[model samples]
Target: MDRITLKEQLEKYRTPYEEESAFIQDFIQLTEDPLAFNRERLAGHFTASSWIVNPDRTHTLLTLHKKLGRWLQLGGHADGNENLMEVALKEAEEESGLKNLRLVENSIFDLDKHIIPERPHVPEHFHYDVRFMIEADLTDKLVISNESVSLAWFTFDSVVDMIGYNPSILRMLEKTSKSEILL
Candidate 1:
């Protein structure tokens, strides 16, 4: 999406939250200089995702991203919806195929900033992400869709050890451990 298209979408989803506001303000500044925004950063990619903690809290589920080919939390494009919490919940359900999982309506995980790496087919842009923690029953029959190469549960310590994971994932780990975003 172009800067103008994304800006309009983001404006619709704008909430009272400071993080969301900060994202818009920064984006407006960035978009004013198209070449700088595209050359120096990512543009028009605002996403939300969920770090779903299983019932036992012994493990968290992750999707092995098909394109990125790394184990990561569930998330995707907002598609113009500004209710980031809803976007996260929708992604969790679509990616995991676990019907019992649900995002707590009133609570959300904190926002984290990351840059999209330059891809062969796409220019790099900044990712302004709003994350959340959703909960699910830990049954052995969890199914994953094609968006991921695989899905698995990992211990907290194991998650911390992942070498190439983005810092935002680590932040979610710390927050999830503290029960700041989960019930």
Candidate 2:
């Protein structure tokens, strides 16, 4: 997908969250280059993440990111991939070591823009993250990659306690709660 296509899709995305709506607008207006993932640009970049849930929708996979030392959803840099959905699924599989993952919806599940603190050679920058919901069997064994300290599934009800409360996670849960996929 090209930038135009992405912008059209994002514009059509419907959500009750005012913040997400504003994010979409900002993303469309901020960068005109297609290679938004280039770290050298220093104008922020696009990232793809999955809010991966078990088949029963009771638990979700999270990775204890080694670099950031935080429990976050599975995802990574776009790496110049214009198709964000494909990026999300690829990251999910690579991070979780799971197969047969299916998208819960074709549309984006969430949107967030956060600042990444500078580390060594990597300078500080913003990440405009696009999130999607993915479902996988709970029985699948997880493999922790070098990028993460560990990987685990947390119950939807206890995720906040397990990983600390995050507004993005809460917003994703709120949005999915109203859908049949989560029900």
Candidate 3:
């Protein structure tokens, strides 16, 4: 995942949202250093996350983020790994405690850039997050990690209502709803 390759991928990514499109353009322009995944790089860092669904696709997994206290999909810092797909998978498995997870596609499923407020020792910075869809059995045992206060599965409709109508989550639900990817 060199800068050139990532730039190409971002260019090819199609999204109906103007904000996301703008984000892609900005990410391409701002990310020049190969250490784009390191938080110390400061410009911003790449993150990988998963929109995980059960086998039936009727419910999705979300973690109550320990720091933010918001329900979000499982994911974490890239830790310098350029292969974001692998990062998404590893984070999903580690955070969800589900062993049989599989990627819905190798291509990017969603893109977002959000500001992370300053923490104890960490300064305020943006997270250039790349998200992917993953599938897992609902019956699989789920173990919550220290990073999360709790984990749960929620229906797409319910999630939208519960999470207070996030456009990104709705966009993912809309995309997956019509595709065979969820099946």
After TM-score superposition, the amount by which residue 163's alpha carbon in candidate 1 deviates from its true location, in angstroms, is 5.5
Q: Is candidate 1 or candidate 3 better by lDDT?
A: 3
Clash pairs for candidate 3: none
> How well is each residue in 1-183 modelled by candidate 1, as lDDT tens digits?
345644555455444445445555664454355353222334645577888887666678888899888888988877655556777888888898878876644444556556677799678667766577787877746678889889887787898686356666776677666764556
Error of 3 at 172 (Å): 1.6
> Model 2 Cα displacement at 58 (Å)?
1.0
Tell me the TM-score of model 1.
Answer: 0.71
- Give the root-mean-square deviation of each candidate in angstroms: 6.4, 1.8, 2.0
Q: Write the per-residue lDDT of candidate 2 for residues 84-108, one digit (tens) a residue.
A: 8899999999988888899988877
| TM-score-sorted candidate list, best first | 2, 3, 1
**Full-model lDDT for every candidate:** 0.68, 0.83, 0.85
Candidate 1 residue pairs that clash: 13-82, 42-125, 42-126, 43-125
| Model 3, span 20-139: residue lDDT tens | 887887777655767787878675898889999976778999999999988898998989888788899999999989999988776888998988898888888889988999999988
Q: Any runs in candidate 3 off by more than 4 Å, and if so which?
A: 1-4, 180-183
What lDDT, from 0 to 1, does candidate 2 have?
0.83
Candidate 2 residue runs with Cα over 4 Å from true position: 181-183
Clashes of 3: 0
lDDT of 2 at 177: 65
